[model samples]
Target: MFKSKEVEIPLRRSELISPTGIGALTTNSDGINLMPGALDMWFDNADIMENEFEIYEERLSKIFNVESFRLPPDYRAPFNKYQQAEKNLNIRIPMVRFPNWYYCSSCKTMSKEVSSRKDSILTCSHCKNNYARLIQVPLIVACEKGHLDDFPWNEWVHESLGPRCKGPLKLISTGGATLSSMKVKCTSCSGERSLRGLTTKDSEHLYDHLSKEGYYKCTGRKPWFGDRIQNEECSCIPQPILKNASNAYFSEVLNAIYLPPNRDAKIQKILDLLALPNIMENIELLKKTAPIPLIGTVLKTNFTSLSDIDNALLEDGIAKIINSEDKTENNENAVLLNLKIEEYDLLASNEKIESDFLVVQPEYDKDGNTLLHQKYGISKINLIPKLRETRVLYGFSRLNPPLPLSTNRKEIIENGKSKLFIKPQKFKWLPAYKVQGEGIYIEFDDNLLSEWESSIRNSSRVSKLNERLNNARQEGIGIKADVSPRYVMLHTLAHLFIQEIVLSCGYSSSSLKERIYVGPKENENMNGFLIYTSSGDSEGTMGGLVRLGEISSIESILEKAISKANWCSSDPVCNEIGMDFGQGRDFLNGAACHNCAYVSEISCEELNKYLDRGFVNIYDATDDFKSFFNYVETR
Candidate 1:
């Protein structure tokens, strides 16, 4: 038996695809568990259909094979001054009640309910005065396959009794900090069971410690899809988890930096026209009839006008498309590498691009010398005044992160393996949001990096790390990319640099994001990283980050970052543990810890894995040659 009510929680448009996205749990001011409904539910609103929330990123569109993306509709209050307020459109992301079990604070009466009205507070009817408020049960059940459901309170309390016994349940706490002190009781039969070992993971089967019969199994319940959507068939054994635990939901987000088209103006326009959903879907028919001329005709039909020059551009664009389709299909790793190469070429050139992507060298005083290159062997520095980043919420996993289906790094995104829409036939676009900001791009000298890598690649310390990374990959852990000494050095430096930038720049460490580019292949050889402001507000675009890219400021920033990496507050212990046994998640880190080289999860692209400050700092007197910046002291 359940009741229904409505509750409204405010969230930013960016948060809709992340922390509070579909299948993820969030709580409101009144401590009610709410989950955003599926994409199908968001589209049911009439206001969303009438308005334009479509976002276009050409590179990402081709990568994900989607025509476009839709941004979450921002809800405006009726009294707001915006245009949507006047119409009282009431556009909001739909949410469903989750962890349906709730308990009365005074009477300890447990009941289940749904959300359907504005006033969603549940009062205890069992209490004599009927004045007690109901609090949501903090525990829920989840499986690795991403199924979520309420804990089996009814079955647990009546474990000693048969399944036929039906009774009201009560959750009582005997005033202790452990789960053994909490017990669920059946009021009618007096049958009860302590919650001991309910959340433990030592058993071979999940929740097997609770009962020897192994009665618990996932119901395939997807609460975010609403009541009408039926539960899917699932055989995964569900495990008990706190409602707000970190392992509950791992959002698989695909991020891409906006790259301006590197083609002729008219040709780019033709390419854009070809990318339209209607045109792309019907490409095969057009190619069968007449590849170039028919495509030009279709473009004219959709875009309304085409001159002789436009027709010529259309012919070239269509020719390139046909050629690409005829070539052997490249895997996800190759596609991702090509995309990075394009960005690397543009940034390394230090030219000022005039589109959404803009990068220019910082101005310096006449007396200011190139200390960064002269002392640290750094090659180039570019200040990006305007940049756009597109983030798409493709899919998610529970218990463990979504793993790649193949050996290819980043292959989880290939073939729509992690697509957001469960039923592909119903939706064509993924949810995405674009943030505009400024950044500082730094590239190391290729020759210097190559020499250093070759010198240290065979060392025992570096080999140990490589073996651990390969083993993790073989075991199907989520360490997607192969770790080279170059990648580790760059990644460690990126973390330390962001930590120092937070002290000088106005933005916090979490507000800045790192994008590391280190390709092991010959043609795709890259050695650079971009530290950008990823905040969704004005704080990110206030020139604080870009200003640090200047010659006067960058030198001090790098010096402090490298100098700090030489020592950690956790010192001998941190370095010793990393050298002998590694540290961090899955022992993926070496000579790095929270005291020194760790940043916020959002800031690190690799989830803070494959980091070793020893590659950057001279941690040992005998291993001075291993440090990339060992020459810093002499300079």
Candidate 2:
């Protein structure tokens, strides 16, 4: 039995009785369970398993198979702090966050939305069956591996993966804080920000990724990349290259690294640029606590007022004999006092008070230098706007601009095929899902679960699985990702760089640029990587002989390219990468890094052993993806 963890899932009060599966699974980690002699167990019904479960096994196995990647010089090069100092640069993978559309229990089918207090209301939408059996009850009984879809690796297939009953995906947080000290922000490209900056609206991502949370649910079942936002048209910053490099005006101290010195002013400006909550209220409170007196001397009463007071006093006695009438008009230009003092008017009457104050741009960088850039260097000004525009398209704030859903977007946001964010609180998108419900789920029966446990423990498949895992893990963000090892990556990087260089000529004959995907054929000690291209009616099938056998020389050329890039790293932001994490050696050791994006000490001998997995080995492909680029720096 999968020790089902009672997750705090949000369901409509009426959603508990639905009969359909609400998504149940067995334990997530096979390695922890069935350690010694756990394989003798057999499934009571292997026939049913073959029908629904076995179809995906072969497909999943291919993802784990090993292959080497060929990277280009820049892509294969490891970036270090000193190198990055050459250019002000930072890198983080951007992902799109989108509203999850799914079938519901209340509706008895797939649904985009249902009117309810909570999300994922499992009640029958077709009949509002208050007594419908929820999908959670028997969800785990369907499969021995305890999964609903594909990706049945060890931990996912085993029954005792962790300390909880298997719960529905998305809702369950994989407990245990593992990534210590890892700082990440909203990947959403923030647009034109006002003075104040931003925090990722989707705390869920930052929170969820931090310390797996509670129980393992699914994340990123889709390694789906967003549609390439055609950079051909986009005008990002021009990366300075090697035409005639110049440092005409600026002078440097020595080999010492430079950082944007903290001018409390700049930090203040940036902070000022961000929305600091409770500011106005704090100001109002300060005003209330301040001292401002309306004294008699300051009031400056007129002599006519004293005379009128005397006359009124004398008239009091004579008023009985003679009927006396006195009139007084309220002065429009005068300051007045009233017993209910708070109501008395003071200075002006206008909606907003106009202030006559001078605005100043505090001159200077954090360092107290004679001057930094001569003038506000707007040479790169064009770059700012283009980058901002792209962020707008991706749904991030520019710099730190606010993106309140305006009146024009109300209708579209509420009732559109796509929404910019998920519900309750909207977050950044810019990234979206290309595939849906792309994850693994599982169930368990005693006999079936027993075999599943044994298969994981005593089977020789573990070693093979590890090899496949190692291949996929080369550049892994999470579990289920096919990684590349360090050595194999160098080969891939070198190949990628060269392919790109060859492609810029625009293809005359049969030779065209082909996107490569490394996979396994029916039988071969060496894994196979397939190639596809873009000039398609043939589905991009035409390309030259795009396969790697035992090619190691590819790494050497790549390393040289990386070194050149790093040497100019001070100018281009990218060159400074690879070495920042102190893993520079590992990333730079070889001509190419493995699929893991490791470049350290890569030799031909290493790339010959491991292999690649098609295009998601994007890490290796990145090796020379920069080959198409040329940087001509101007002094």
Candidate 3:
């Protein structure tokens, strides 16, 4: 029987519960929490995992260069007593106390153990109060080396451990009620100290007793585990932080765009055969012995019988699907090239309508007046009425930004293991969320982009972006240096288009998201980005976005989008910002700000970094050296 029934909220795999949310849900709220369990548990708990989970795993792992991605169980509505199941995928995060010290509001008595019952009623033993109101201590100390512990209240009040007198501690709050006004006192030894000036603005001098020389060191407390007493080895100085502060814990999630394995009808047919359940093991045996009539009869059960093809032909198709392979390229370029080729072929097909594979149509004609294509160096424009995007949560890091490829994987991944099972030896899979939506794809002309990359200012822009990437790598932030003039230009274009489209289209700017394709000149170079809306709602697949891509409507969109990019509300100040040293997180950008180019944090692929309006169209009409689309004459 379950201990308690907590209200479960349904959220997409993409919309993950932040680390702080996970902690608060289990500790602060009266919700039923489950532990991480076996892979089979997800199948039992979630229907989506049981049916389509493996396909996503195979596709996503290749894209992200991961071993395997575990699918999170779909959260279901609360069950009735009779419908209760044996397994629940709802995870119970490790019980790490927020304020390590819990204070009784009535008696002002401070104790580490404030909650007396499983029902979470705070009872004070000092005042003989059965139900005492407890306030969580907001003060916490965390080191850069990923260690957390309670503030040194005992040592701070006494200033030293000289007398070895065990004393009862009480936190006294005065009229002022500021941090300095609140003082800690030892009721037995009569030792008292004010908590003023303990921390500076940077939190570097967290517990300096005298002149910043004498400071408290970290004890390296790891309370997330069951033992609750293990001290990890650390050398870094700990910084005092509030429990709810943004820096306390950061959730580092890695994401990938799902690309189909094959688009050819013949290849797809062969793949369909290989995908048959319990068929791979007996594939060879069936090829050698099974006759066409028997195969036809077997096919009748799951698919339409293929009578036209002979046994020899059928065997060759199956063999081809099994042996089909491509030369392995480096992880970084390979993913972009794959997406580029897929998008290129899809758009080049020039299909006006295809109802089966969601609404997607390319607006390209040999003689049609494609305004962006002819005038602005845009190669292709394709509208997607519906698409699906998957986001997965694998592991997280606390102080240091989690690097997916960094060799120091053990320290972070183990620490962020789903608070499901206690310390599993091997971690293979992670949870994923999927959302269906619509978008527009824009591909840039290759020759024009190549010319723009040669410009001095554009090269300078790329160098700064590379520097940011290198810094992120040195700090173990798990990012690759894949910046290019083509990338920056297209990214900026996507951002500007998003802003422009929101004004004309009914969709909100926040609802649209970007998927960029950029790679080296040696390979199949990609210079494009897709801006789409992916919502969990049923109305996400509306054809409004595709209509915007139509020839009649697109000419005006391009004209307006260019006009918007040419001049920002911030104007000279925005364009004049030097990008040589960089400005954002890693000094990765130039001439871009919130008033002109910034989109919602969720909508941007680069976290709103590596964007500059100056790269798209020249901020000043006279300067064309820095701009890719600057040479376009007014039509």
Candidate 4:
């Protein structure tokens, strides 16, 4: 049986829903499409079949006018100029995102350096090369508002950014629109340039180019300049978006968070990779919050209650998994277990689904404690090209047609190659998970949401630590400051990476070493890493994390990973690259050659042909593996 009830929310929700096309709503062997009726009930509570139904349809009609996206009002202006209006509204305003030029009474040359940040004084490199004390001004701002709407920006060019680069100002913003092409002269320059952003594909590039090739008025009296480039001298103006001091690394930061949770094996690995403890802890915490569906081999096939997950958590043999983490460095980095694709797919397709096909067979750990292993093996063997994947969108609303980012007809055929759109397109929406269909509207218990929120907070402690490290790199901060938080953050991130390798990559090096963790080790594995539960009842294998001397170089390992990540993330044909773990090389060089990262492109190829191979394992009696991850920070 299924039902739904209406509830008042702070605001409406929105998403990028799949259109009624080849790749709209889809169903696999897991379950059927549960969106339409399920969502209807959650949003409406009146007589579902009678007069209430009519009213519900009317409300939904109004909401779905713009591609069925619903959203709440957004007040925060976007950092970029693209984000504007409510989340549900899709509006693209024809405007420009470029730099305007401004002339200085003193410098006389068009060489002022613009500031990228909303806050900051403009400067000049040419002048700074000589008398470095020149004051600059803001002439134009790359305003990120609801898709640039209105205005015949294609007609006239060169508008001065009035006053400081603050919004809602009296600048010649797109707020005023004209039907025909209008030529507007620059207020300060009297010179007019063509406005091509409105209709041209190169608008964004031209807009950014404004800061570099600024608009200026020439004296025409005499060619007086030190630079070699022609037409480098001008006077009249407004300025372009400034070049930020940190633009060198801005691309790197933007590249890191782009792992699509649905596609991309690397990204999928990143998300699915979770340590047993992390998975267990989160599952236990969530069980206390809502009704979860579950199935058991020896038990009955029913929806999982907290008691069921509890019994599995406490009574199952989890100790063995924990104990496996207790190996010494000499024998650590060993594979605890391995499974093929058929097994992994079972767990990968479980969320938003319910079935008995993926339940684990219960087992006992080496320590004689109970544990149950849940594994999912996602593989290419299961890719059904003919079967379209249903696209599920979240947190977007606009009033305009929510067309996919396809400017050309061919792009429609190949959605894999669409126009690039920046994320957070605007900060119009924050993330909150909600089931798509109607069933028991399992609202999060107050206590449970709070706990999950805390975990998210704790999870970010690693990011904070990284930030602190970056800050420390700069010499501005005071000396002798407490660096403990930074250390804790790093340690946590290392653990997170370990979790990623094990859970996401399915590559476990748990049997490299054996030793004592925070608590006593009841059961021992061949590796020197420890198997134990802390006083806080945190049961986990503390493999090679008791000292800094182990894993002799964390930076080297991270740097190596970054190189491969860059190649895989940026390359277009990388999708065809197979996972061939052949010979393993020293992944510690400042320059970790990508060709050397793996053994071979064919997983079954000769192991010794390359490095990091499944064959010819390090199996070193030395504690090289153990020394790598023994990242411990003493308080």
Task: Identify the leading candidate in terms of TM-score.
Answer: 1
Q: Which candidate is the best by lDDT?
A: 1
RMSD of 4: 23.6
Per-residue C-alpha lDDT of model 1 across residues 1-635, encoded as one tens digit per residue: 23545676878898887766778999888787788877776767554553378888776777667788889887656655456535425777888888888889888989888644345777777786456778888788898888899988877776621366677889899999667688888889888888777777773234554455665778998888777767888888898888998889977777788777653455667777677777676676777667566666776766553444455456656665765675455555666665665566567654466776788887866645456766877778888878788888877788886664224434455423333455656566888988888889888877777777777767877877887787777877866655788789999999999999999989888878999888843223688899998874653378888888778688899889998999999989998898888898778898899999999987887777889998888567354256888744343
Span of ten consecutive residues with least summed lDDT in model 3: 31-40
> Residue 339 lDDT in model 3?
43
TM-score of each: 0.84, 0.19, 0.71, 0.22
User: By summed lDDT, which 10 consecutive residues of candidate 2 come out lowest?
Assistant: 382-391
Clashes of each: 5, 121, 7, 89
Instruction: Supply the TM-score for candidate 1.
Output: 0.84
Q: Which residue pairs come into collision in candidate 1? A: 5-115, 5-116, 5-117, 6-116, 6-117
In model 2, the Cα lDDT at residue 471 comes to 41
What lDDT is obtained when candidate 4 is compared to the true structure? Answer: 0.22
The model with the greater lDDT, 2 or 4, is 4
Tell how far residue 385 is off in model 4, in angstroms.
17
* 439-555 per-residue lDDT for model 4 (tens digits): 000011223222322433343322333343344337332222222322222222222233323332222333111111111112211111111111111122232222211122222
